[model samples]
Target: MAEPRFSRFAAIDWSGAQGHRHKGIAVAVCATGDAAPTLVAPPGASAWSRDDVLDWLLCQDTSTLIGLDLSPAFPFVDQDGYFPGAPDSPLDARALWKMVDDASAADPHLAVSSLLTDPEIRRHFRQHRDCGDLFPGGAGRMRVCEHGQRTMGLSPTSCFNLVGAAQVGKSSLTGMRVLHRLAGRLPVWPFDPLPPHGPAIVEIYTTIAARAAGIRKGLSKMRDAVSLDTALANLGSQPHRPLARYDDHATDAILTAAWLRANADRAELWRPQAMTPHIARTEGWTFGVS
Candidate 1:
């Protein structure tokens, strides 16, 4: 296949903590070049709500490859079904996305707390407060791409493990609601076909971008300008301007956006060797993980 020619690249460091505004959420975007990425200020607030991200993303007008820093589905092939033994298990990722969205429809701000805490499904997750009764032990089950990520020496937490600092369970769960909404507007990679034009979303683990940028594991979180620019330079991107404050969330989005711009055209990234059709329909591959 030929290289994808996106006019722009965007990286969103998402959050799933329950609230109207999330300090963990960060969005950075850059054009189709080596220019530095800039963090987008939240609309009408100090922090961005989940709804704000949905609105902002839908409004973007460009052939952009949007990278969401969250998993869009749970472990499927590894366990045969997301909620194993449950007769109502989704047939595929789309059904899972709808199941998540439907569970949280009445909730405010696109939060998936209801779904996480639901009696019938809580047993499958290792939530912050308690490990579910049927929870798989030790970071829970891994997606196929996650196992590949492991071979590359990067750690990927399970969407079923919501505890600890590295936990992405909440974000992954909440992101499905966003993906469900963006289904038609923004076709998610692997699960949805690449459109002839317009924006599309893909799962991104910022750590992968950091690794490619020459930043070592466990030290990929840049909390200073010098460190951030150093990593950006490793990716052949221009140094970013000073931020209001130095933190991992903002730096992650900024650095990963530049990384996407630098690497988006690689044809091989769109086709990982281990990515079979079944895996694509279930636990979609991360964009840069091949």
Candidate 2:
């Protein structure tokens, strides 16, 4: 008998502060390389102590390809609110909710549908009701473990901005709508009804590409949207009238590019890897990407 081949897949819906984090992260680890992912936990209890969470994360099969909903980078701001750097925001749920509401009002087609109905969505906002925790202050506690680098959290505004634009939209939508939102644009709108920012078209593109790649189910209608032939043709490149800038859309495209690059057999090719750091181990954490 031969040993079975397997692949470990995981994703996190990151949150900080008391009660703001999801109940449990949506984790899917499988012993079969091609097996469909399964939910490891609900949206509650997802927040474990740092050590325990790290232990669980590191304990996963070494072949795992972990996708974190948290931003790995932040945005750069020069002037005119046109932040050019990576995106981030403070961990304040109220502020985030307000942003979501404002952004949703800017465009009707931009909200993630699941967020509108998901009970947990409101839970996230309600958790931060009274505390006066400020932004840029709690970043240190919301650190992201990227490429083995240990650092404080990226600016939540940057993450929201990057995702709200186009470069970092996939992660944001995933966090906002749960994985279901990434199912692709079709009968369902990708933006949350009360989205923190304007609709992210690039996220739409990424969702289409993800559906084409078979990462999501029940999106047969989106097949044509993410086809490689369509991507190569670049036809219908222009989407509906814009309420936001290209950078927002570009953020989604960039995330789609990452997903496609990571799983070319599934989606269309958009951008190539420009740079990837070799993560070094710190504090007993051996982190690095091949």
Candidate 3:
């Protein structure tokens, strides 16, 4: 079979913080024949808003495959839904996305603080507190894919754990809002059907791309030009200039974009053994996690 090919590849390092602009958000893009990915900023803006990214995505002309570094859904299978015992929890991933979008309707830039403020929603998470006793038994809060990532040495965190620097719950929640808005415009992999031609977005773990680029674990970020170049080279690309910045968000976006460009044709990534129908509908799987 012919391999999948896209005209352009992009990756976004998303942030869930409340604001009109965020430094934590970074975007990188590379063309099919490009030697390296380049960090992209909004045309007239220094920083990118979640809305800015959505607008840019909608304006794209070519068939693009964008990788987003956030969890697409929470641990629904194991927990029986977002709100475990609550009778009104969402029925599926689409429903969950709508719930998050609806709850954060009043927040600027799609910030999910309002959803976190809810008594029921806040109870399942460990936010800004080290208390493990809040959750009953404090286990199974992570999804099956998260455990799979851990076994692969990626140090995946639970989407339900909203606290700590390593937690991705906030980004995921906010991303779901974006996903809900992009429902018909762009097809999300494994959840929505792949279109005949156009843009599609997929969930990505930047650490997985970093590992594929021969980066060692325990290193917090890649800032040096040599290391960045080497990592890009491993993914069939090289740095166009010195990527000496200390921002892990920028580096991750650059690396993952190149990785997507280099490896998007791999059949194994599209088909995972654990991506059952229920899991895809309730708890989405990471694109590269098999």
Best by lDDT: 1
Q: Count of backbone clashes for each model?
A: 0, 44, 0
Tell me the spans in candidate 2 whose CA falls farther than 4 Å from its real position. 1-6, 16-21, 42-52, 76-273, 276-290
Cα lDDT tens digits, model 1, 1-290, are 76457988899999988878988999999986678999899998999899999999999878998999999888899879999976698989999999999988888888887787688798888876788888979878999999999999988988889888889988898899998898777778989877778888888999988888899867888999999999999999989989998888999999999988888878788889999999999999998878
TM-scores of all models? 0.96, 0.31, 0.93
Candidate with more favorable, higher lDDT: 1 or 3: 1
Instruction: Give, for candidate 1, the lowest lDDT window spanning 10 residues.
Output: 1-10
Top of the candidates by TM-score: 1
Across residues 54-162, which tens digit of lDDT does each residue of candidate 2 receive?
3455344344434444333222121212111214332322234344444344322333333323343322221223211222322212112322132211122323222
Q: Whole-model lDDT, candidate 3?
A: 0.83
Off by over 4 Å in 1: 1-4
Give one digit per residue, the lDDT tens place, for model 3 in 40-144.
Answer: 866688889999998887887688999999999988777677787665899888899999999989888888888887877777777775333335434437777
Overall local distance difference test of candidate 1 = 0.88
Assess each prediction's global lDDT (C-alpha) against the native. 0.88, 0.29, 0.83
